[model samples]
Target chain A: MSDFTRDEIHRLALLARLEFTDEQADAFAQQLTQILHYVETLNGLDTTGVEPTSHALALHSVMRDDEPRPSLSNAEALANAPEQEAGCFRVPPIIQEL
Target chain B: MTDAPAYATLKELQRSLEAGECSSRELTQALLDRIEALDGKLGAFLRVTPDEALQQADAADAARRQGRRSPLLGIPLGLKDILCTRGVATTCASRILRDFIPPYDATAVARLRQAGAVFLGKLNMDEFAMGSSCEFSAWQPTRNPWDPTRIPGGSSGGSAAAVAAGFCPATLGTDTGGSIRQPAALCGVVGLKPTYGRVSRYGLIAFASSLDQIGPFARTVEDCALLLNAIAAQDPLDSTSAPVATSDYTECLGREIRGLRVGLPREYFIDGMEPAVEAAVRRAVADLAAQGAEIVEISLPHTEYAVAVYYICATAEASSNLARYDGAHYGYRAAGTRNIIEMYSRSRTEGFGEEVKRRIMLGTYVLSAGFYDAYYSKALKVRTLITRDFAEAFRQVDVIATPTTPGVAFRIGEKLDDPLQMYLSDIFTISANLAGIPGLSLPCGFTAEGLPIGLQLLAPAFEEARLLQVAHAYEQSHDWWRRRPELA
Candidate 1:
């Protein structure tokens, strides 16, 4: 794999929904490259036609019986909101307007 | 009542309570006082619930007076901060979650509450269980009870240190990548990581869903088993919780290890490991063999690739799991953001620690369009090989024994600058989480510096009974764990 460029680091920071100053991005670019190189050690063994094990247990999609249960109340659900309106989470407006 | 009950095992405390030697209020108060006096020096607890604990203790006493005899009634225990407690602050040692409190308890916490367990408080951990050392906690680092200057290991360092300091008999900790076992080793206690689906994960703040399993850190293997017994159940809320045959884990104790096959993985004792620590584990395995257990050499050749595969897989999952913290719903949010996009990114940038952001960046890169196949998908296929290696190893042996960590506890800030070196600390213990098996760590011996060394044992899934049996046999022969840390 080619070395990760500063542009690629900037792209990754955006993709991960994080912001970094110039210095922070530089440090992360170097560190992430080192870590990626380390993890790339997995390529040594050829896994030809091997099935990827997603979950350790052979778990079939488990469905419980269709039953009504006590779910969290609306107030409880919105209890920890950083911004809250009338029984709902308040968020910044889209389309460049509030 | 005497203050000595503060350090008694869960079993001993249960017996004392049943024998009417002391009231639950007395026991809880004594431990609360002890925590008040000592926790400031140790930095083990993030929050202590003296009033709530006393109320629970009083209720337990009332139930006992009316003849209810649950094993965990009035037993005080601490939880790793990642597990949500109803109405109690559940910070995963990150500023992002510094003020988040759940409206309901985690399945494990709920079960413990039903078992009449008293909640002393939540313990500290690495932020979102991301790092191997407790120094990654947004709060202060938890000191080693054995030597206050040294680390107690992480991200369940506080859980292990609290148990070691005799603040509580046992505490709950999560092991996604050796978080529980590594700290248990460093803190001179017993820690168990059950099979991935053995315990319900309804309210564990996810770090890596596929790898994390809630387990116990205790002063003894039996206490670990007791805690497991209370929490291990198939929950409807957690789809991944397996509907497997359940054993009363406490009942599995005291079984003979005679004729049990133990496998020693050669790759585990590699050169970078401390020779004295490895020798301590060797002596532990020999004692198991001396008790009529057969020792066999085994090769899990995919062991070398575990740390690499784990960092990829775990980070990739963490990147997705942590996306919910975008400043809208809960937790910390960057203020004065003119737009939603800025709100999302800036909130995370200011909220998370250095290691968390790095993992997120790496995860995003690997899962990006040009790199997904080369990194994340390849890791899954390699993960299959790593799992199969254990399947093959288990075919010949009942359990695998190794050092929990390559070395004993190091001083704080030792590996903070070198992230690669810090990640290598969980080298031996991560593969078990990768393969989704049960792993246990017990205090095997102490180093020349008197820091405790851990002996780790792994068993196949749903064989927690066998795991506890072997661990109990080995623990019975050694007095290494009986020595407590002198905090005064």
Candidate 2:
């Protein structure tokens, strides 16, 4: 089994913005390693000249007209907002700087 | 009601409607009532559109009165809440859009609406279709109708549960990986993930854009086919929708499976698969063989790498697709954000569930400056190998057969603590998504515990017709598709 350390797991958690306890982090480290090791079985293949297909079929080329359409009024749009101010969605200060 | 109409096949319901024994309004209200009765315990719907559904059912009854009827006419269906519906809440089961109503309808929604089908409301799902179990939804976990303590498989868990519970006759779901088929297999419903681009994705919230496709969840194979006929086709609005030939899928049903080469992947019968699932799947294969299908043991050697490669590629694409939800344009915005970064971070932090956030971070990491090739690019190369494996295997077999999941529905909290274990549940179904192949999950047998088990039938990409044919033949001989959850 691969040794996925607690530090690495914590780093990944940081990257992932997850607030995990130390115990949770340890568990995740072990689980992720096992899962990755299990999935490593795909490494044993010969994939020459086979094109990777992102979509099964070719999509239509046409684009819709960029015409103006009726839109939800600001009142209707924010009608369900948890919090709103001055016809806009209220939010915590975005950037402390800039 | 004669034998719980929810368990009846789409053809049976259509026949009943056509025979004038029951009006479309009656069926629609029956489902609405069913949802009202059980939704408190099941948590299947995020929103229930009783008034709108009644109005649409009246229209359908009027249309049928004039002898203008289609297979979908008067059918009551549910949306996965990920697809936009005009003036209806399309939350994607996230708090961000919990109250957000789209000003427009998705191509699939608009098509189904025009076909005279009634909407039963939005079904709960994983936040942004991210989790394999419905536990991840911001609302509440959708309980398996068969056993309330267990989860219905997910991120389309709500759709699968609703169909199995008879909350709606059928539902629309989006599969990006194994969201549709995996849950269907777990819940004992039929779910079809059409080959990518076969259906329009416009107005369906993006999860992993490259892997995502809108699909159907129904009570039986024929119902799935009927729904497919209504939804699948070219849509100019979605640039990625294929302009393919639209043949009625029902035409291919009820055909014999004689001479069809069914592939049994030696690799899919992996070490950890439960003995019960194995026995059930083997019995399905034997039954298919009895029905004159030739079972071939085909080896797709690269099957093992599917989960990792799918995670990497899917996450990378998701990172890009979800960048649109950065609190700028639409969706939920966290309050008191004075600046841009705080606005983006706080909105995302508040709006997305833990699983969705984790995916976004993993996706962001894989697509970041230094590690793209090691993770994303290499995964793409591995994806190519996996696809080639399917192509090579299909050369000898017309379709593939496998146990849809490693085991039947585990308890709701069984794997919730371990995300990796949850991810492994999709292993059998993900490769088809990776290869952009069409796959279906149909009820084959019940687990020894009496929960339903599903056998997955996979067809080469765009070969939905063949998949339906195989499923139809199986349904004819074995009437397991008629089984329903006995709710007290």
The lDDT values for all models are: 0.91, 0.83
What tens-digit string does per-residue lDDT give for candidate 2 at B359-420? 76567766767767556767777887788888899899999999999989989899987877
| Candidate 2 CAPRI-style tier | acceptable
**Chain A alone, TM-score per model:** 0.89, 0.77
DockQ for each model: 0.85, 0.33
Best candidate according to DockQ: 1
After superposition, candidate 2 runs with Cα above 4 Å error: A1-98, B1-4
lDDT, candidate 1, residue B249? 93
Most accurate candidate by lDDT: 1
Could you estimate the TM-score for every candidate?
Answer: 0.98, 0.91
Question: What is residue B248's positional error in candidate 1, in angstroms?
Answer: 1.1
Superposition TM-score, candidate 1 onto the true structure = 0.98
lDDT of 1 by residue, B456-488 (tens): 999998899999999999998988878987777
* Model 1: lDDT to the true structure: 0.91
